[model samples]
Target: MNFKKCLRCGCFFASEDSVCPSCQTKDEIDKNSIRNYLANNDTPQNAESLAFQSGVSIKNINRFMETKEFSPLKNSFK
Candidate 1:
């Protein structure tokens, strides 16, 4: 079995996921907030701006971007 530490919780888990299940739930919530913010607003935002506006962390946003989960908003960067 492969064991890896979760980036968010720093707990070791046996999986290929970057974050553990608990942190994944929280990340989902954050993602929803970011999506809602993007849907409701037209202002261009970069990782830092999005983090500030959505109350999410820059690390999480960058991770999402890196995984291409937030590719639609990638072009919104200013």
Candidate 2:
């Protein structure tokens, strides 16, 4: 199996996903939080604002926005 570095924790692992298993769970939680925040409030101007309001880190927000699942959100940010 091929080993890849975990984007969130910098650990090496064998997986197709960007982050390790543990971080994947956190990513999901962050994603849901972002969705809920968007549902309740207007879209923020950028990742920093969204991160601040959603309680997620700007790094994760930026990473998520680049994914196909969050591609639609890309338009909402700068």
TM-score of each: 0.86, 0.92
Local accuracy of candidate 1 as per-residue lDDT tens digits, 13-39: 999899998999998999898889888
Error of 1 at 59 (Å): 1.2
lDDT of 2 by residue, 1-78 (tens): 889999999999999989999999999999999999999999998888999999999899889978988878878778
Quickly count the clashes in candidate 1.
Answer: 0
Best by lDDT: 2
TM-score of 1: 0.86
Best by TM-score: 2
Global CA lDDT computed for model 1:
0.85
**How far in Å is the alpha carbon of 25 misplaced in model 1?**
0.6
Listed per model in order, the count of residue pairs whose N, CA or C atoms clash below 3 Å is: 0, 0
